[model samples]
Target: MVPVTTTQIHSRPSLTIIGGGPGGYEAAMVAAKLGAAVTIVESKGMGGSAVLTDVVPSKTLIATADSMRRASGASGLGVELGDEPARADMRVANRRLLALASEQSNDIRRGLERSGVRIVIGQGRLVGPTTVEAVTESGTEIIESENVLIATGASPRELPTAVPDGERIFNWTQVYSLTEVPEHMIVVGSGVTGAEFASAYNQLGAKVSLVSSRDRVLPGEDPDAAVVLEEAFVEDGVNLVSKTRAESVERTADGVRVQLTGGRILEGSHCLVAVGGIPNTAGLGLEEAGVKLKDSGHIAVDGVSRTSVPGVYAAGDCTGVFALASVAAMQGRVAVAHLLGDAVKPFQPHLVTSNIFTSPEIATVGVTEEQVASGKYQADILKLDLSTNPRAKMQNVTRGFVKIFARKGSGTVIGGVVVAPRASELIYSLALAVSQRLHVDDLANTYTVYPSISGSISEAARRLHVHL
Candidate 1:
């Protein structure tokens, strides 16, 4: 963060933020730094759903699962990993993830206090445009500020027939409570969250069956990238059920029974419903405060995080914007910056990068292949297979690729998709290229370590240079 001189106002601008997730706590820090007297109203300790339940915990579990995957695959690489499933301990992994979540929440709270932001623990809501009411178990407190930001995050949507019991039937958040890996895990929903857990648990020595309503997994992601990930999932022994929706999930005498479309039955030790997330917008008094909400119940906000009513703003999953934690943090920063009259940049969807945490991760940013194919934008695209890379051969990596899209005439990098191990890490250069509008030649000329998988990124760019 760049240091900026405090605003020379007679009285410091006062900002009150509701919720303490990345969108709320990060904004409080920024608002305080910008010379605003900041206060945060939170009910879920600190770090909101992202840290306490969703992103942090799930990623931690995936890390353990990844370690297990590497250890199990070592024998093929001439490294004998004796006694399979020794390190794949679910109880330990669950305990560690919960500890990490709690610690992260505390850290965020401490950081907010250190930044001179006041923390109010309660369920906060908008009473009027600039007035917030926080209700706690003991009492209620009303707060008034020049600017109010609603950053309450979201929660996993429960199926009408399959409510999570936090036992055999679990939601994404409830899975962190597992004492043992499921003997056979039936995951419903083939989106990022579903695919991630399915991959992670399967890596952790569980039989995973992924159910998708679409014809293939990751319906919203790039089709080519989805193909690669689906292939990897199948090779890893994941049972892929496509074009079928779960009619119901019921616990059986010994395990669980999932009734799919057309009367199909899947029996598994556990069931996970990763259907989707609904915004935590109800009961927030948004409508009474003249804030417009979308039909989907998400708070509607403009680019600068301004809601329907002036002096009221909303960010994060609540706003139904890009759902990544990074995007939420940026929205919060933008909200505070714009509110404090500081230099600000509106949210940029085109520059947003997202990754699916699968065995072979899929990361993408900027213009999509669909948009280009539909003549939404005239751009040249290039895809270089990771199998052709030197590092991939050395690592015995067989799948995934680096795909880049550039302007048709100038070869300026506009978009990209990467499917490989740690594709999230390999995608930053492409994101930077798109953000900075760097030409293909610029990326192609950049230095990449020899025998690196990331070389495919620059190689893809180099290939695209010829398209123009």
Candidate 2:
């Protein structure tokens, strides 16, 4: 555990947070800052899956693979790598990735402690509206609070026929324990997690196959962005099996065999299942405490993160309202503000931004093309390919584009998408415009650095402004 500096004590309103993931810890900090005495109960390590297993570990692995892929392409930039080529040591990479995950988790714990939030290593349940029962290795402890927050988070959903053995068969969380890079990896499911891992491993030099139950990868994302990624996946030697689902996964003599819905079998060194996630709400005494839950087992909460029971709120994956970590943090903060008598704004998910960290990352903010086609809003759309950007040419980036959507007559920027190497970073300006209801002319007037991918944003805005 990381050490933190303790401050002088002061009497404050009491608040308790169950689960120390982004949602729990973030809310704890907010409540503490607002002069609330905060206690966080967590069964696993701090930072939850976002740090210990799912987000941090996976992104760290992808970063290593991304660097290797960049080095392999250095020849195009007139860079030489001697006679021998670069190779990644999977054992060392996995070890470093796990270390980084642990370090980040500790950092989060320290930050919370520094904010005067008490951390408890235990499993917490809602015994009453404002009471919590924590069971630790030491013993059962009861805590009383004016407010309670449930953020137990979620776990990877597993299919009965494709249960993970944690060796040849794995879930998104278990893949980090592999001692060697899989010679071939079959990734089932085409959601954000599946697409990202599939693309990362493929670039990491694994023979990768992506099985999608939908017509294309990333069925929930922009169709144009998906098309670019699917093309790139195939060009990079990834066998994409579309409109197919994995029926079952069984270990063979040396590897694993994945049977698809159509009787097709894919043999690989390992199989990773990324179907979805199941909320961790059972046995937590939520129902007994009068907290309503959806049929899917997720806590039912309003925009301000309020549950059916007053003084008891929920956030993060457990609420099933936008699984992104950023959204979770915001939801947590909102819940704390409402509980602590601070001015609070209900969570507006439409203002949130989401990203997929694949080779050519895909990012979007606000309204989507699907929403437009659904006739919910009338908007003009514009797209500018990165190939036309001078910065992209200099960086040898041949794929991706910047797309913007604006109201037809008003020219207000409603939403946008970016597909490029650093689309995650480039989507912020568009996010700001959409959130603030800034018009296309507002973005068009903004000055962008020369020879940068961001220039495409302003350029697209200029074109949209002309039509308006």
| TM-score to true structure, per model | 0.96, 0.97
Query: Can you give the lDDT of residue 109 in candidate 1?
Result: 88
List model 1 lDDT by residue over 1-468, tens digit each. Answer: 322222112367888889999999989999998889888999988999999899999999999988887887776678875664445778888889999999999999889899999998888888778888877766777777788999998999999899899889999988877888789999999999999999999898899999999999988889999999888888999999999999999998988999999999999999999999999999999999999999999999999999989888888999999788998999999998898889999999999999988888899999999999899999999988987899998887889999999989888899999998899999999999999999999999999999899899988887777642
Clashes of each: 0, 0
Alpha-carbon lDDT of model 1: 0.90
**Model 2 spans > 4 angstroms off:** 1-11
Quote the positional error of residue 224 for candidate 1 in Å: 0.9
The 10 consecutive residues of candidate 2 with the worst lDDT sum are 1-10
Alpha-carbon runs more than 4 Å astray in model 1: 1-10, 83-87
* Clash number for candidate 2: 0
